[model samples]
Target: MQRGKPLPQKEVAQRMEVSERWYRNLESNAGAPLTPEALIRLSTALALGPDERLALYRHVHANTKLGEPEPDGPEEARSALTHLLATHERYPAYIVDHAWNMLDCTDPMADWFPWVREPEANLLRWALTAPEAREQLTDWPRHAALYLAQLRFALVSSRDNRQLGALLDEVLADPECRRLWDEETKVVAYRQGHRFRLRLPHVSAREITVTSQVLLPAHRQELRYVLLLPESDPAPLPNRGERDPAQCRS
Candidate 1:
């Protein structure tokens, strides 16, 4: 209301189709009850930008439903990944929800990353809990910190998620993970590449550098693809000749 050449409250109230007294009440109390739709109108009338709009959502929807990035259904997310899986056949890739659960993956991803194929698997949970991870990731401790930091960031947007809460419970139970989280370091979401050293399914132990990235689908912000691209041609690549049918399925 008082940004620039202040517009009259009466006219503002009239434009919003609300009584001036009600508008005054809203202006006075920041905690006033507001539906999501009403907040949109209010944000726009105030000429709030995208960030301000989110701030409004964070405030108004604090105890109720989340504001934006409304997710596509899990099944729909799964169906969408089939196309993505086939497209990224040369690289290891898997899709995950905000909760970090693996919704789908390319065959090479399932072959190379054992955790992705496991049922009820979450990327964060797997990294922090899997015994194999300690040996697989050359930089386990640092990567763990980054992954946990990312989880903490996601929680701000999804305070009411039961599954995330349960996941938090399980994470807090782990002494090492809890300690790192307790430190409250500003690690944020994992976005960069990492060097991995692991014993393969059939091949000899291998060390490879792979970068991982998250891709949000056009229609759904929650459904994201975590892709691992090799930094360079891996030594003695999977199969010197034709790729294995079982390992590189489309």
Candidate 2:
């Protein structure tokens, strides 16, 4: 309902080159489910971002008890996050579940860490035990320590969730993880504007800012989105070179 314009029904019909009556029915949620074409038209008319557009489609036809079940599986959640991440090509974006598991990543992420293609990789594990973690992180100890602290916070906040709790135990069972967790230190509270600089396998160390947002009741698992952006534009970094940075640090 944009101001100074005809009703949404009329405007939508004109934009889609369809009958005003049909558009009215659709707008009123009385028409049949939207076809892909109709959905695209509506999305365009509304200037919807990928996530917003997907939400709109889901809203129109979703059958969940509530709108919370659209991303029920890892793949569905990945797809949703991927769509949003695709919107930012220059930046690296990723989605992590409540357990701090890295669920999905964008191309820029792969460019920074090629072995991210492995079946399932946890950012927490990599940050703590991977040698590449040490090499890539400009301030290895500090970043690793901060990451552990964040994971601890997430664990405490979601203690009642069996799955999340299990993940915490599994990660902590690793000797290195245990040592880090044993340290009775806590960092500042998690905030979105924090930034860090890290060196990648073949890439020169570059500064990157981290931004995070909570996707409420996300994907039935309280998943969150964490995006990484350049602190300032740096020359593009290499993807992979002589080292396999994915291996665990000895």
Candidate 3:
């Protein structure tokens, strides 16, 4: 479909570089499974984002790989990810699931962004709706827009995810968030190589610049590790137990 209107089957077949009959059979769910190449072509023809592309792969996987292992439960995933977070003790690190729900964080992350310790902490919700976010994140508009863009990207593949749908509804209630959601069309799913200034009241009065890098566990692609690495050129701040910041930027 192009926007809200449905593209003709012939047009879709043409875009996929496939015969109209073949596309119709695929659409009717009455043909052999698509090859990886065909799937890629279909995804491209539909203009799917990363999440949607993954969704397409999973759909094929479900039909073919009945012996695949089940996903790790929340508690199991949290325990494993705790060790992962500890490994990055020098940086601000945290784990989030597909819905951007905070599962765990390094002590340094909690110190710098205590909101992660909140009940049922969700990254997109706080970033988009919380008043504290504006105070802590410099260039709030850009940051909020990025968060919203990620959510919009997720929406493509997470249409059936109740948590994601609820989170979207809650954030869109805010006037500013609603405006951003309506106006932002970009689809950025990760924060790789994104540097932003942050103010941590418990850390230092001065704003610190940090580049956010997102990583995925090899086994659990649904979980993401968001690590905030302080630009190394600046003099780092002193650590004071769990109350101190992890890194500093001048």
User: Quick one: best lDDT, which candidate?
Assistant: 3
lDDT of each: 0.67, 0.62, 0.76
State the displacement of the C-alpha of residue 67, model 1, in Å, after optimal TM-score superposition.
11
TM-score of each: 0.64, 0.55, 0.74
Better of 1 and 3 by lDDT: 3
Q: Candidate 2: which stretches are off by over 4 Å?
A: 1-80, 173-176, 185-191, 205-221, 236-250
Q: Where does the lowest 10-residue lDDT sum fall in candidate 2?
A: 241-250
In candidate 2, list every pair of residues with a backbone clash: 136-199
- The sequence of per-residue lDDT tens digits that candidate 1 reaches over residues 72-110 is 575676577667778888877887777888777777677
Ranked by TM-score, the better of candidates 2 and 3 is 3
Instruction: In angstroms, give how far residue 232 of model 1 lies from its true place.
Output: 1.9
Backbone-clash count (model 3): 0
**Where in model 3 is the C-alpha error above 4 Å?**
1-11, 20-35, 46-74, 233-250
Candidate 1 global CA lDDT score: 0.67
Expressed as tens digits, the lDDT of each residue in 61-83 for candidate 2 is 54535544365576666566667
- Backbone clashes (count) for model 1: 0
Q: Write the per-residue lDDT of candidate 3 for residues 136-213, one digit (tens) a residue.
A: 899999999888877766665455678888998999899998898777566665778898998775677568889988
Stretches of candidate 1 exceeding 4 Å from the true structure: 1-77, 185-205, 237-250
Top candidate by TM-score: 3
